[model samples]
Target chain A: MPAKKLNLRKRYGLLTRGMGWETTHQKMDDVFPYDSFEGIKITDWDKWEDPFRLTMDAYWKFQAEKEKKLYAVIDSFAQNNGQTNLADASYLSAIKLFITGVTPIEYAAHRGFAHLGRHFRGDGARIACQMQAIDELRHQQTQVHTISHYNKHFNGLHDPFHQFDRVWYLSVPKSFSEDALSSGPFEFITSISFAFEYVLTNLLFVPFMSGAAYNGDMATVTFGFSAQSDESRHMTLGLEIIKFMLEQHEDNLPIVQRWMDKHFWRAYRLLALVAAMQDYMLTNSPMSWKEAWDVYFVENGGALFEDLSRYGLKMPKYHELATAEADHISHQIWSVFCSLGNATGFHTFLPTEEKMAWLSEKYPDTFDQYYRPRFEYWHQQQKDGTFEFQKGLPQLCQVCQIPMVFTEVQTDPMQISYRVTEHGGDKYHFCSDGCKDIFEHEPEKYVQAWLPVHQIYQGNCGGPTLPEVLEWYKFTPEDIGNYIGSQDHARWQEWTGEDKEVKQA
Target chain B: MSDKKNTVFLILQDNDDARPIIESVEQDNPEATIQYQPGMVRMEAAGRLVVNRETVEENLGREWDVQELHLNLISLAGNVDEDDEKFELAWN
Candidate 1:
């Protein structure tokens, strides 16, 4: 018996060449037109032979066609005034979190892959980088476009890109992106593309997007899955590169391990947004963010890190810490939303009794006693027409990029809350010191966070008026103000014959 | 990518639901062995456990692609060792 020799390039070319990359949904048979990205070669695609080994023509055609079909759905939904069937008013909150947190990851991927486009010694790796670059851009754009649809229907969406710059809790995402963007190009690839996208992203995308499908937000669901299809390839590239590096030099082991350790923690913290959206916002069969993390981050990832220990790299230093925090983080974040909705660019409504029950079932430790009462008060206020948003901005955590809402983890799992520590003249608050240390690692990068409240205070936003501030944030009229009265809710009412606005108190 | 044999470690949920998947592997493939713990399954195979696409679909009684595997997975960690034809998932 002869051992088979591996040719990564040949395998890659088999997967991608001549696929009609240009036209969307022409046919599964159309190969990726090498001419699509001129002068870039996909043959080096062999760097990591995808076991599912999607051939080029089928790959491009399926992808382009999927995008095309998705776009058509978007068009029809918009044409017939389709935003309303979106199931519930609460769903938009999930979109708010997605726009604020996940979309930035696309841009971060763009920056990282762009570096891979430069660093890969082979044309194959470099070409994969090019495709990834385009994919990331489209992901970012599609997210923005899909989210912009809600702008006319909700708030908290004005200039999400800019909002990312200035929002308090948004610092969580902003800082994560900045961290990935700042790493050496290869490390960036491992952290964002491989570790974040390939390893953990499926947890967020596949399930959540499927949830979107069940809800009325077809556009969002479509785009999320479409982006994920591309992510499959990017994941391969990430896996290959890390593996290739390990193969190239034994010394690369420790270096790669260090990066793996650094990046896994960095990416995990950014996923806190998923914690909130999954557990709190989804209209149906909501998967608790904590459970999602256990499966996605802790179990899947923690297991992987243990395997890598043979290389002398243990699990990411913060893995346990991040895992330990998951069951509690979403409630902590939404706690801020409930308490601070007025000052926010988006709306936060009290969860229904049914939803509250679901949450209590999911978060047994804190919900019934700690968080639910607070939401109950907000519900009462809503009934009374006296609910007030947190009037001002929160101080942003320098490292995690979140607002200082996180609680300290006591020896007992029962109590979790926030801890603040001061560094120099600036006071740094964190969900925990793990986040604080992640920040202390590169305070220079994080110190410059653009907190939304800070911007409002600095008068850097449009003006003193919320609307004016929204405008400065690049949010349009439909993009700003109370979500209940926003366009999406209005459209939902019209479609369901329920009427759009909640009559003013 | 390391000179060392690539390994994949998976801890399955303790629920009784995944028994079929566990049983099928143990019975169908002599190479497949599963040790059950309090809340998880520790599966260690010397090399990749090949699941014919056809076989998986037949067993699951639905379209069972790689993505759908997430359903049965309690937790999985492994290196991707492969060529174009097959990718191996193994324990170190």
Candidate 2:
């Protein structure tokens, strides 16, 4: 005798619905609460479809298989001394940024999804979030395991979890993820799942994964492919939630649209680091930041929004500004990072001739005409034994908490964009209109931002001197300074028998 | 097929994982024409090209997720209308 066969449609409904009994002793709000804070009315929760149609048995089976294969690759990679196979030692700088900034956010996402899984009203939505929560946790673990191998052979990766909480630059991602974590269930899904995952995830994942493939980092490339397979499911959840909300009630549309506006800009600001890493860090880069942005954002995102317009939702506010800035943002951000290199972990140096040529070719309008001359000046300064690092604290945006480095949209790339507003009799500064709008919407929230640079100036971060600050950041001499003379660079030269002067020239 | 119906196509990396999805598309859209490149398989249909979840699950012999198509998706052209039920590519 064989087990009874059940159709997937029936099984999905039965298994997912489980057995819910309405509480008679307690009010519905008191029992299953946290759904109505944003006034998103839901008349029919059953109409919310489960896209994956995943059950616990299938989930565990597939997840176990993914982990098994990934661990196998990790083992083989370690056996091969995989660190020595990258395109160049400087390539590790991208990984350094990733571990310090992005990996911790994966953990934050895990916590956020867990909260959503527990709190959402819809059973389908709860199951979806729970699966994603587990997926995020898996991502964080695999990322730590994958990058920990590099920490053994590298300088800047040793204290990334600590760095994520305390470092000045890392506060960008820390604050961004914290914002999502602290939001209500509806806002969290709209912000993280819908806006960040749907509209902006490709910008973060594709370049780094493709870069990993090109840079001879088999471990990271393997993990990236595996993570992206899950991300495909995550992307669908994003689309589904937005549609579900819009279809549920007319009032939900405005709320969802406002969330779309707020989170789109927030997610875009976070990816500034990715864009800079893609364009400036990778020695054997696959594509320019502008190219990736155009392909992923302008074309693909444009199409996605067009598809959604039928639901009465519009493209995010300030979208045109974001598209226009793609040509210049990465260059602008890298220039800022280079100017402040001494204060940070991970080495920074002038782009090699080939890289400079690539930048000029890829960004003919901005790189050659505007940004290249500045890099040339920095190189000349380096040649004259007068390497400069930006000193004095830069102002932080109240909402975004990033340094005021962004330029005016559709204008000169050098002039820093700034906006000022008065809330509760205290003036607030923002880097762009997007940040300003966010601050104005919730002045109480933005005012409470834990700005790192401000904390340092207030003598709140470990101490007052450079050594004191570096000690507070747990940075070694090898971790901070020019890449040309860093330990990683020296080891690369020794391993490959390549001359530093020849490579630099 | 109707007038002014341009061919819509999807290119997925040719791999073991994509075989079931390719088969699903082939079965779902009877008129779909598939071509093989060095490491990719491109499928084109005259009006609309669809990859069905039910068909893919049958081919995979297990539960199939519609979003899993992105695992092997290299690139695609035309307006995409996707849900749990199917992934359809068309001009309109």
Error of 1 at A163 (Å): 3.8
| Tens-place lDDT digits, model 1, residues A1-505 | 8877436446556444533133356632243322222122223333544433444444455557556756786777777656666667657777877887678768877877776665554455556776788789888988887777767765566666776776555666776777777766666777776678756786777557766776767788767766766775676567667666665556667767666766776677666667677766777644577776765666566555555555565666666777767767778777777676655555665567777888888888767877788779878887799977766666665566566666554464444446666666877666666666656766776677665666677887778887677566555665444567666566667657873433211
What is the lDDT, from 0 to 100, of the residue A328 in candidate 1? 74
Candidate with maximal TM-score: 2
User: Fraction of the real A/B interface contacts present in each candidate?
Assistant: 0.11, 0.03
Query: For candidate 2, what's the TM-score of chain A, rounded to 2 decimals?
Result: 0.97
iRMSD (Å), candidate 1? 8.7
lDDT (10s digit) by residue, model 2, range B12-87: 6557888999999998899999987434566888658999999999999999877567556655545556666788
- What Cα-based lDDT does every candidate model obtain? 0.63, 0.81
Q: Under CAPRI classification, how is model 1 graded?
A: incorrect
Deviating ranges (above 4 Å) for candidate 2:
A499-505, B1-16, B19-49, B52-92
The TM-scores of all predictions, comma-separated, are 0.74, 0.90
DockQ for candidate 1:
0.12
